[model samples]
Structure formats: structure tokens, C-alpha cells
Target: MPATPVADPFDALDPVARRATPRVRIAVGAAVVLFIAAVAIAALVSSAATGGGAQGTIVAGGGAPATDLGVAAASDGGASGSPRVATPPLLVHVLGAVTRPGLVELAAGARVVDAVAAAGGFTAEADPAGVNLARPVVDGEQLMVLAVGQAPPPATGGAGASSGATADGTVHLNTADVAALDTLPRIGPALAQRIIDWREANGPFTSIDQLLEVAGIGDTVFSGLADKVAP
Candidate 1:
């Protein structure tokens, strides 16, 4: 018997099935599109993650906390503050009618009374009336307190009120008592006292020229006494 050709039954029912395996081809095309879309979405997600990580690393490395800097600065400020230096003490020679007479350490601007107090106060023979207790004592000064009716030494600075004339008739500016200072023809008792006060308050006279610096001594008085005095 001769073989006859068979008709495809799916082509009659579905027009879209015109090509061989048309349904299968359509399904494969849709799957390929979906895979490409998924790949693209994954690429975008990876790029986003990489960019975010790099940005975080940069921020962490570059930005230091402000609080840490402030703390460091405050600590440095405390260490750099100024330091305090102690004041140097004064050295005075306390002498005469004080209970203990010797070198006494005192604060600056110490007065005679303070010096006396440091020297164990006055002795029974300390003629407080003879000394100017309120006067400010200087360094290396000899402070002497006389007994009642006791005469002051020739060159002594503290508590000496009388002027003494030298045997040679020349008065020493640093050593002469008030009496010797008054021996000048133009100088009197008041002027003599002024000279002693000046000598005591100021340091010893370095030169006879310093006589003019005395309160009562003018150029004329100094010139007259100049020839009669020595340093």
C-alpha cells in the first residue's frame, strides 16, 4: 500500500504555533529577557555597595572628633600656665640693747621695731626713747639702742642724737655726731639734726659733695662746711 502524509493537529487549533515549537520559543525568549534584567539589577546593587563602603572609609579616616582635640588643648593649657617665684628675704644687722644682737633675717621694708622684735625685744637697759623705733632699717645698718643718759658713738647710725667734733677740727660725714655737724659757722642745732637724719636715712656719705643733698644744706651752707668735712 502507498504511504500518505499526516497533518499537524496543534497548528489548526493555535495560530501562534505556526513555527516549529513556537510556544517553546516564546517561553525561552521571555526567560532570556528576565535573566538579562536580573543581571543588570545585580550589577547596579554591587556598584552601590562598593561606592558606599569607600565613602565610609574616607569619612572615618579624614574626620577626627572635635571633643578629642578640645581635651588635648585643655591639657596643654594647664601644663603651660605660669609658675610662681618666691621673694628674696632681707638681711639686717640688729645690734645694741636688744636681748640678742646679731644678724637677723627679715622681710623687705622691715622697720626698726620689727628688727628689735626679731632680736628678742629690748633689754632692761634698752633706752627706747633714744632710738627711733618707727624708722625703717636698711641692710648692713648698725642699729644701736643707748642706755639711759648713755652717749652715742662717733659714727653710729641708730639712736645717736648728739654731734661730736673731731680733735683735728674736721668732721667726717659718715662718722660725725650732730654736735660736730653743728660746729659749722652757718649750721645750727636744727640743721645738725637734719644732717644726721639724712646720713641715717640715706646711706653713708660717699663724698663730701653729698652734703648738699641734706634738707637744710644749700649750696652756700655746703660750700662753707665742705672744707671742714671729710667722707
Candidate 2:
């Protein structure tokens, strides 16, 4: 029997082709890296051209506009750089059963009720008479309304003060007049006259303590009048 000859391993392969496996793998890897780099570059270019953010910056719920990073005008800072404007002033007066009744400055066009509201509103003893809560207030005007069953405010002199006082030895300075000022235990017509004369010399009193400045009125007299008067 004759034996068959085996083919040589080296003889079956081309010499040049044997070296191509490493080069082929390296070329494929490079192609993949280049494809990834090309996609990244395209994305960057698209974002720059559209001026939107990389992830997209379209605002929801009616907000500000999103500008592209590419536009010069959008990035340059908008039309006006100044802040908001301020409003004007208003002035009104309140007089009646309130904590404080006097000229009050407020924003212009403020209502009469607003002035009353500022003066701490009507007091518990305030007279609802002649008072219209819904009425609009005008500047530099006066509002006078007392509470129900409440006497009208004392006149701005000694008589009003004595009338406003009670058996408890207290006076309602808001309503006191010249005659009322004489009603004080120690006050007589002469001293009362002095108080009225002093009040005429000065404008509306700012503090009851200022009463001491009147002739025949000293610390003793003023101390008695202190709790009995209001500015």
C-alpha cells in the first residue's frame, strides 16, 4: 500500500495576506473612532447654528426666550438696563372717633376710608353720624363723624374740654373747649382764660404736656390736665 502526502501549512497561506490581520483590526478600530468623532462634531455644529442649548432650552409655561450661543445680538444684553420707576405721594386728613385724627400723607388718589383706616379706624365710642365709609377722600379735607349716642367732639378750647369730662374727673381732649377747661377742680375762669389765650398763641397742641407752658399753668396744673387732654 502507498501513503498519501500531507499539504504544508505554510504553503496554503499567501505571505502578504498573513500579515494583514493586525492591520485590519487597527483600521476597523480607527473607523469606529472616526465615526464617533464625526457625530460629536455634527452635534456641536447643530447646537451652535440653532443657538439652542446642547440639551435644548425651549422654555415651558411662558418664560423667557432661550438664545443660541452663536448669535452676537442675543448674547449682547437686552434693550434697557435700568430698573423700575417709582410712584407719587398722596395726602389726606381724618378727624373723628379715631386713634389719631390729623392730616395724613399718603399715595395720591388714596380713598377717604384709607385715611380713616390709617388713623386706626373709628373708635368704639365713635359716632357713626355724618360718616360715610364708602365715600372717597379728597386731599387736605377733613372728615368728622362721631359714634352713636356719642356727643360731638368738644370744641377746640376750654369749654369743650370741661363738657367732655365726666364725674370720674377725666376730660376728652378731642372735644374740650374754653368753658370745659374751667371745670377742672383747681381751674377757675382766670386760669381757664389763660389756657385759651395760650392755645390761641400756639397752633394745635402736639402733646398735653405742652399745656404747662400756659400762664398760671405749672407742673401741678399740667399733671392734672395730662390724662385729660389729647393732641
Candidate 3:
């Protein structure tokens, strides 16, 4: 009617409503942008964890590569690949005259003699008497050898030689070197050497009676050694 009520463009839009519309649009755009960014970040993280690549790249802590534990030493001093030696089951028993007696296990084909040596060999007085040094040892076999110069130890197990009920025992004069002769009660190194020198100079004694010819041996001394001496 009045020139169609010439409307003002500014008046056509309400100032308060216009301002509110822009704010709403800005907030909705921001929310959509945040959602898209979040989706992109999540996709990237998932791909990294599962080892994604053109083909399939290995990633540490992901489904990646593995190492062989049985590797031999490499040029860098790390293992690459190899095998280990397998040990055999071996057992042996050592007894008699050894410093320690017991059962021991060793590598297969180990010798009995080796087992005895492992147990500490023979004691100072061990009787090499009946022992066959060259005999091959078997598992669980018992070795018994006597000590030097002593009577066979009684089966009863005392380490000392047993004294005879009468007159003790006789000493072997022929085998009695100075060291052996020293076992006599009062004899010492000097006397022992003297006796050994005498025996060496003369032939083997024919009888126990010939001992008197040695220096320092007289009737009374001979009587004392009568039961103790042997030819």
C-alpha cells in the first residue's frame, strides 16, 4: 500500500535472533570439526598398534618379528643360530683307600680310575697292595687296596694294623731300608742309614741271626729285636 511498506533490510532481520543464529552455527561447526579430528586420531592409533604398512611392516610391541634364542655368536658378539651339546648320564662308585668314598656321576665313557682320583686318590698310607692300577673300573664296583708295609687291615674296619696276640709281628729285614728300619723303637735316621748301608754292602741276610753283625746291635739288643726281626 505505502510503497509496499518499503521494508528496511536491517529491520527485516531481528538483531537478537541474528546474533543467536551465528553463535549456534559456530558451535555446531566446532563440534563437527572435533568429531572428525577425533576419528582421524583413533584410526591412526589403531593402525600403528596392528602393524599397518603397504604390505605389512613389523612394529615393536605390535604383531611384528621374533628372534631365535638358539643362535650362535655372531660377528657382533650376539647369537645368530646354533645348537648345544647334550650330556650323557654316567655314574661310578669309589671305595676303599680314597680320601673320600662315595658314588659320583660323570660323563659317559669316563673311567673308573678317573672316578677314584675325583674322590681324592689314595690316602698317605693306602695299601697299593692288591690294587691293579691298570684295571678298568666299572660302575658300582668296590676297590680295596691295603696300605704300605702294614698287615692287611682286618675286615672289621679299624684303620690300624692289628697286633698279634703273641710276640706282635715280624719285620722284613730284607725289605727294611733305612726308612723301614726306623720303625724300630729307639732307632733314628743315623742308625737307620747305618743299617741300610750295611745291608747294601753285604748280600741279603741269610738269617735273623746275621743282624747282630750290624753296628750297634749286641746280645742285649738282639734279644730285644729277636721276636721283632725277620730275614
lDDT of candidate 1 over 1-231, digit per residue (tens): 887868767648665556657678889999999999999999989989887445422224444354365564476564334754566766666666889989888887888789889999999987787656666665655566666666554533333322334555667777654445655768754576677788878988898888788887788877788777888
What would the per-residue lDDT of candidate 2 be over residues 89-141, giving only the tens digit for each residue? 66654666798988777776676567778888778887544354544444444
* Model 1 misplacement above 4 A: 1-84, 156-213, 216-231
- Writing each residue's lDDT as its tens digit, candidate 3 over 163-218 gives 11113445566654333355565554456456656666897777879877889877
* TM-score, one value per model: 0.42, 0.34, 0.28
Order the candidates by lDDT, highest first — what do you get? 1, 2, 3
RMSD of each: 15.4, 15.4, 18.5
For residue 67, model 2's alpha carbon misses the true position, in angstroms, by 5.8
User: Please, what is the whole-model Cα lDDT of each candidate in the order they appear?
Assistant: 0.68, 0.61, 0.58
